[model samples]
Target chain A: MKTLIKNAVCLIILLTAVIVNGSGQEYVKLERSRNLQLNNTSAGQEISINVTDEYNYLRIKVEGQFTMGSLLIELIDPSGNISRNFTIEAGGVNTSDIRADRAGAVSGQMQKAFRNPAEGYWQVRITPRKATGSLRIYSLQIYNPRTDLIELEQIEKDTDEHIG
Target chain B: MNISVRAPISKKSIAALVPFLLVSVSTSLAQHKITVDIETDTTIWAPVAYLSLIPDFNYLNTISYNHIIEQSGISKEGLYEFSTEYLPEEEHLYRVHFSKKGDPPASLILGGRDHNHFFLFAERNSNISVTVKSGNRFINDLIFQGYSPNKALQGINTMLEALDSIDQNGNIVNREYAIEAIYEDIKTYADTCSFPLPSLYALYNINYAKDYDNNPAFYRRYLHKWRSQKSLYFREFRSSIRGEIKPSWLIVIIAGSVMLSIILTMYLYSRLKKKNNKNPLSELTIQERKVFNLLKQGKSNKEIAEECSVSVSTIKSHVNSIYSKLDVRSRRDILDIEY
Candidate 1:
């Protein structure tokens, strides 16, 4: 009986260990534009972050000051697939309840499922709405949870912005 | 004591029922019609203009329809088009667009002048003129026609300015009164006129003045009176405005959450199952892994075979399996894999 319990505990621990390593996350910083005041015109800013690790699940979030849905974010994965996209809309967060003051909390997650991601260039493109306002701390963040034992948190990448 | 009742059928009884049904159907079909005079100086600008009568009263993201002057433009996703040709005269019949009889009201915009640039309430038998002055008037109101836009664009502009307008001491004024006043103004038009555009003018006002958004009494009692006024021009927008307002959002949120939960549960379960069943690392055997490590380190097949005390052919076979697991081709491709 003691041996049976011991074997069960060992099996549980092994399963837990594999599960812990199976779900690993990496954060990628895409763009950083601080304290910007935009007018009655639109501007687009883009950046590329190299995700050296392969992942199955991908999520995107924005930390910004141009209101909830004023900024449009489009993410292109390394394999040239548009992973996540959101734009200025009429009702769902875009054309209403925008403050021109301090920055707010991180946006809700915009998630996607990848068949199998490549380890190459992942692009984040942003299109601020054609509005006149003041803003602070506009940036994009990516959280990728992988299924492999690869250590994504260890790989560090920084890149320049691409404007359109 | 209660009495049970049954009536026998007759031609007279059936004939009486016919008038009642006909009255119901005719009342439903007797929709409001408005003649519009849109005088565009075609000599001033290009003959092309875009027109859209999008439904604002919809909670679900229903695709709306529009038309182009030249009819040569391509349709984009979510926005569709109807075949159109300019009547050559500025005076045209601005079709009255409404939902089914006893349905939610819809708004209309006209511009021989410009594509959906002016807000003209699609009222029953409303006669109005919208003549754009010198420059382009990209607004949806009668302000540019005969008077200055200040007072004419009241429903559209007043609500916008009221939202963020500050007081003398630099404080944001409570916009309740401002919003209430606009509704009161729209109510004046809604009461005096039986047209669809007037109701839509009031409807569009509620978009900016959100406090008055969901009123079942108003939709059921007032909008239900004008169902027969639906036109093909605004057919898509007409069908999309459905059900009670807040419940629509609740249903959408619940449905969305349930779908996401299912997807996430499946995704995570698949990942766990793949890890257990595949044992991904075991795809390459002990010998193949050693060969893989050597190949990653830039070693030739001959050198790897010599180091492993095996023939070159054996090393080649191991290398092929390793390459297959890693989804790569050739020795150069497998060199320096960071993942």
Candidate 2:
């Protein structure tokens, strides 16, 4: 009876671990969504999102109901190099980041040459300014959506959670 | 004429010297006299005026003006005509002062060396007028009333500058293109500038910078219209516009065009990307995308319900909503999506 009980306990723990990891992994498959809370934010605050190798394209979208705040997001590759960036501002300024805008997209798929990408760890850094609203990350993985040919769904989250 | 040589030499030597002297005298005859008639337009003053020439216009010598100090006495004596022996040079810059004793000081008289062949006719108009060629009398009495022969001096100065651009640099820097550019500027100014001085300046520019080897009278038409306008605003506006645009304008246009192109490209690219990422499933709430992702992964309605910390019926309702948006009938259709 004790051996049977031990086996059952082990199965439960294993299953729990699998569920958490699976939740994270499956979320990255396509149009992955994640929520990050911003509260009483002050200066010198930063958040980094590391995109691992396995996804073919890289695009990031930021959506949230912000009453007052600004955020600057930058992409860093595995080589520890910054690749792309974007800005969200209610009232703020843009930094003097890399000015190579010919390949301007900081949060889109691989540029001009298709099927070829900077295959490695791509990191995302977010710097917030007077931010007090939740920022929704609509994509958590290298995304290749099938039916998103003509539209992007505005995220319908609880308005109370996003509005500052 | 009787020739009597003092008796210091022989008759043959005198005869030889006489012919040589006679030939030299005839060859070196003094030039024809310059006859300038100065009379006020409002009241033809006793045709008395004195004319003088200065080698350089800006280097005016106050002491030399209004005096009887000319090689050929050119003084107005109770008459409008003043005569001085013609200068050896074909063209000269002259200043006119009334010969009347109580007349206004010569300093009060303004002068300009602008007379080109145009001055021949200008010798006929009202402002200060002059002529290098003959026909000063036929000079339109209308032109002589007030003319400044000094306009040519300014043109000559600019012409020298254009030449110097080539000479001072020892021809190491080519200025033909720049001179041609200035020619175009002058032509445009001549075409539109409403101010008298600027139009005059434009005539000067064209006269100085143009390659007369191609067209000498290119600026001739502009000279006739160089009348001072009554409206200072229009005059100043027209004069101010010429130098405002240069290659810098072209640079601004190109830079602006490039900046616009870059902005447009970025905008379109973002829109295309947004379109490509469009999915009806994206409209789902964060909770719904979570459930939808699980559903897309071939999870059964029960598995999604079990994993989500929600009841099975709630999960079923979410699935049905997802199916409605995906335009599919069931979970099988969601799995069949070509993601």
Question: Judged by lDDT, which candidate is best?
Answer: 2
TM-score, candidate 1, is 0.28
By TM-score, the best candidate is 1
lDDT of 1 by residue, B1-339 (tens): 999886788889899899899998987665322222333333432222333333333311121222111121222321122222223222122222221121111111111112223333322222233333335343333332222222334444445333322111121133335545655655555545544544444454444223235554655455466676564322432443443344577788999999999999999999999876764446777878788888888998899989999999999888878878877888777774654
lDDT of 2 by residue, B241-282 (tens): 333323467788999999999999999999999987897666
- Candidate 1 runs further than 4 Å off: A1-164, B1-67, B71-129, B132-171, B208-214, B232-241, B245-339
Off by over 4 Å in 2: A1-164, B1-76, B79-258, B271-290, B297-313, B323-330, B336-339
Lowest lDDT 10-residue stretch of candidate 1 chain B: B103-112
lDDT of 2 by residue, A1-164 (tens): 99999999999999999975654343224345567766546453334444544644334444433334655555564556443343433322222321222111111111111111344544456676676556565443333332131111111122212431
Quantify all predictions' global Cα lDDT against the true fold: 0.43, 0.44
- In model 1 chain A, the worst 10-residue window by lDDT is A93-102
Candidate 1 accuracy as lDDT? 0.43
